[model samples]
Target: MKKVIIAGGTGFIGTYFEKRFNDIGYDVKIISRHPHNIQWDDKKAIVEALEGSELLINLAGKSVNCRYNEKNMKEIMSSRIKTTNILGKCILDCNNPPKVWMNSSTATIYRHAEDRPMTEENGEIGTGFSVDVATNWEKEFFSFNLPKTRKLALRTAIVLGKNGGVIIPYRNLTRFGLGGIQGNGKQKFSWIHIEDLFQIVLFLNNRNDLEGVFNCSSPNPVSNAELMKLLREEMNVKIGLPAPKWMLEIGAAVIRTETELVLKSRWVLPEKLEKEGFIFTYNTLDKTLRNIL
Candidate 1:
């Protein structure tokens, strides 16, 4: 069986990948802070895990669902950079390193643009703490010299799934009748079904010619109003209370998550994936929502 090492494999995406790979006959090994398979601090264990592995995927990072205060901001950046740096070092030292390394990156690195979609080739990187974190994370990921390894930074958008992910909160809001248009409702919400995300990974793994950054999102992005309308319809809800920017800010503070998560316009496009002829199972908003709901 092919060996696969997934760093920080305890989270939602990691767990999903673990099962998917396992189902396909890959021996999936998870490395985390806790000792599920191997602890993060165990250098010898991590090195042993990576030895002769076919793929190395690092999804290790602090959750950005909290208030971006001084301490949380520092931690968020440190967690991602530190884990990636460690993995690069290990891969370099390995006698037989993994052929492919897929690191986690966010589409939030693009500026809040309602005008155009951000693609791998011609996307404009944004400023501020979120973008800075993403920039540095990718920098560290590609900084290492691994001639044998094909590296890819997954610039992922909001991933929707039935089990656990951003979908849970959205579903909860819809059930409570608060799943309405946020702000002026013009913000673009670029997302992908969880299955499509896994497929993209598989697609890239199969195509050795593809490398570097690939935006992992649905091509058909919808505005905030349209997204909420679809969510309401999916949940069979008649009414949903709209939230102004001011109200969103207050709610974000109460929930301890950043308002930018919902307010920012993330119009990311999977140009590279599409150009390579990767077909998404749930391409449209309505179809994706129906599958998830």
Candidate 2:
């Protein structure tokens, strides 16, 4: 069986990718600070896990749900950049490095937009704390010394699945009949189903031609209002509170993440993936919602 090493394979998306690759007959090797039961030093872990593997997928990161204070921000950046740097070093040291490296990236790197969709090559660079986070993350990811390993930086959108992410809260709110729009509900939110995300990662892992930044999001992104409407309608929720701007600001302060990020208008689109002829099984909001709900 073909082998692949997955850093941060114990988390939500990583777990899904692990299962998908395993189901397809790939010998999946997982690596992390403490991955399930397996243990290895950073340098040794990466090289050993990737010894005969075809690819290395990096998904290590601190969760962004909490406050992004000075210390937490430092931890977030270091967790991703330092781990990536160490992994890159391992690859550079190895005589036979993995053929492909799909480093995790975020779609929030692009400037928020209310109207136009963001293509990989055409989107505006973001500003503020989140942008700084993405910049450092990318800087470290591209600093590896290896030349044999083909790489792709995936600027991914929020993954919506029954098991995780922004949708879970929405699901709870809808179930309790407390669902409503937040902060005017006009900001655009880009999303991809968890299955589609895993499939794209696997596709990129096997496809030698796919490289550089690929915006991994659905072509049809909906505004926050539309997303709320769909969720409430599907969950049979009626009569909910509309969260005002001040509440979201207070939430931002309380949660430690940037208020602007939560309210950022990002109309992201996956131009490169479509151009490269990658098919997304869950593209439409209706289809995706039905599958999960």
Candidate 3:
């Protein structure tokens, strides 16, 4: 069995990665601040795990949805960068570095497109809260100078699952029949089904040569208004409530980040993943919505 080490393996994405890798005959060891079963400090634990491992995945970070002030921003940036820096040091210490080091990244790296789809080859490098956070995070990750580790930086879009990530807040509002288009409602919403995300992780692990950055999202990107329609329809709720942009700005600012995220207009497409011939089980928004519901 291939041994694998996961830092921040207890987080939102980390938990999912753990279950998938563990079920497939891989010896998985996780490093976390509060270990549920196996625990280790990132630097020391990574060196130990790298001894006979095939892969190492880093998924540590503070939530980006909270306030983006000076303090919270620092925490968000530090959490990702610091953890990876520790992992880099550990990899340096390793007698033999793992075949691959897959780290969590964000689609927020792309600059805002007016309405064009942001492919891996042509994704915009925006400079807002999302872009700033993502840029700084990636900077810290690459600061480590370990050339041997086959690095996989996954630029992930908003994940849509029945239970978590970008779904919770949207589900809450949709439950109350408040699901509607935000701002102009034309903001592009790039998303992937939870299962598709898990499958992508597995696919990346299996493919050794597939290194560098890859965008993880459905080929079909939906607009904010369209996504709202689907969510309401999926829940069998009445088509009610159009959240004005000003209301989102003033009322429930964080709660309305969904509106902002959706309204931001990111037409992101996974050109590289597609070019690499990765098939998605749930590629359509309605199909994904039905599965989750």
Alpha-carbon TM-score of each model against the true structure: 0.99, 0.95, 0.92
Pairs in clash, predicted candidate 1: none
Quote model 2's TM-score.
0.95
Tens digit per residue, CA lDDT, model 3, 145-203:
77777888889988887656878777878999789877778778889887898888778
Descending-lDDT candidate ranking: 1, 2, 3
lDDT of 2 by residue, 201-229 (tens): 87787688777888989888988788888
Q: CA shift at 242, candidate 1, in angstroms?
A: 0.2
Deviation (Å) of 110 in candidate 2: 0.6
Candidate closer to the true structure by TM-score (higher is better), 1 or 2: 1
RMSD of each: 0.8, 1.7, 2.0
Query: What overall lDDT goes with each candidate model?
Result: 0.93, 0.82, 0.80
After TM-score superposition, the amount by which residue 228's alpha carbon in candidate 2 deviates from its true location, in angstroms, is 0.2
Better of 2 and 3 by TM-score: 2
Candidate 2 global CA lDDT score: 0.82
Q: How far is candidate 1 from the true structure (C-alpha RMSD, Å)?
A: 0.8
1-293 per-residue lDDT for model 1 (tens digits): 89999999999999999999999999999999875579878888888989999899999999999999999999999999999999998888889889999999999999999999899889999989999999999999999989989999999999998898889998889899998889999999999998999999889988999899999999999999999999999899999999999999998999999999999999999999999999999999999999888
Q: Candidate 3: which pairs clash? A: 110-124, 110-126, 111-124, 111-125, 111-126, 118-267
Residue 156: error of model 3 in Å? 0.3
TM-score of 3: 0.92
Question: Candidate 3's C-alpha lDDT?
Answer: 0.80
